[model samples]
Target: MRHFIARGAGLLALVALAGTASAETVLGTPLAPPALNADVTGAVAKHFTDAGGLVFKDLKPSKARGGKGYCGKVATAADAPFVPFQVILEAGAAPSVLLLSDADGASPAISEENATLLLKNAGCLE
Candidate 1:
């Protein structure tokens, strides 16, 4: 019985390690989610006309394209609630702004039919 318990513990440890191994990073550093720095916020703001009022939070490196971009939640104003948003950047290509919606089908501009899939693709969802 002790042998079996030890084996189970080992298996659990391996599973935990595997989960951390697959996490995406912006600067090749594990356990550090990307920050919503000025460059990233600027890149996203350029796509909008009035982004001065926007506030970003919960930023993370995108898993797509081998962690080449960033994803997070943004609030249009201090009084507004935060919404999921993604900015996928590619070399020599304009950044892509993926629209997302909240659980109630509101926020992030509008309710997109593919919001869930987009969120998944952007790594906004687990």
Candidate 2:
């Protein structure tokens, strides 16, 4: 009876560890752009304007380490709820735009449909 109980506990621990690992994998690491490109910058700007109806001012672009692509920051409007966002651009991958909020910046507040449309307009999605 003791051995069976121990085995059951061990199996439960393994199952818990597996669940954690899968969750970490699902929440993938964030990507940073390594360089700047005119096309990508234009695409991001256009996406923000067309989708959110918000114009990005004081936009500054910088090259990310390890030559990934470009990373940039756009000034947030005073009336907006969310803070200024950080945008990441990669050569062949979809652009990752993060809205830095006090609650959780990793998960953006934008709707799924709007996010898809924004990405599509930015040429990051097909």
Candidate 3:
């Protein structure tokens, strides 16, 4: 009985180690995700714009490409609740996406549908 128990414990340990072996991580390295939030997506666009010697502020939406949608600068309302926000939307078969860069100069926020608009109205998406 003791021999069997010992063997079982060893096998369990081996299995656990094998499971962990397949896991990998990168430390202190920046790898961009396929889809990002408002802040990250804006940063990515800025990266490309800066690389191309184009002013980020002057950037405009081209058109929807594939499953992606696009948005330009934001319009602020004085009597509103949310912040000024610039956003982009990408509509695909999966998730309808929205990206917001806060024009309020506070923080960038990401949301879907009206949530992004609400954040914009709240002045969080800068």
Candidate 4:
């Protein structure tokens, strides 16, 4: 009976420790954007390229909503049918990119399906 009790207590302690470690892993670690727009630009360019779409040639800092984090515009390539896109970067969190369009417009610059695919491919949720 004593041996069984000790084993159960050890198992419970192990489970508690495991839970704490998993929580820390899910909390995420912060990351700083690379200098000269290398990190953000590269990630966006790769996303478009992998999706077989027009690549974003220029990425410049832009206004962000709520002023919470960094935001930028992904400029459209010359003569490309694609409209400009925007991206928001938050430290220790995933970046979000969206196609620009009028609020009243029925059509979005990028379809929701494509946007999700691009983001997933770019590992933006990480």
- Give the best candidate by lDDT: 1
The full ranking of all candidates by TM-score, starting with the best, is 1, 4, 2, 3
Give per-residue CA lDDT, model 3, range 9-88, as digits (tens). Answer: 12222111121111121123222342333332333333221222211221233233331322333212223232122233
Q: Deviation in angstroms for 62 in model 4?
A: 2.0
TM-score of each: 0.56, 0.34, 0.18, 0.36
lDDT order of candidates, top first: 1, 4, 2, 3
lDDT of 2 at 69: 29
lDDT of 4 by residue, 3-119 (tens): 222222122221111111111110122234434344444434433423222234334454443432232334334354534444555667544434433212323333455444433
Clashing pairs in 2: 34-64, 34-69, 35-69
TM-score, cand. 1 vs. native: 0.56
Q: RMSD of candidate 3 to the true fold?
A: 22.5
Q: Please give, for residues 15-86, the per-residue lDDT of candidate 1 as tens digits.
A: 111211111222222224233355556554554445656666677776665465677766656567766666
Model 2 misplaced regions, further than 4 Å: 1-52, 66-82, 102-126
List all candidate RMSDs to the true structure: 16.5, 18.7, 22.5, 19.2
* Global fold similarity of model 2 (TM-score): 0.34
Worst ten in a row by lDDT for model 3: 14-23
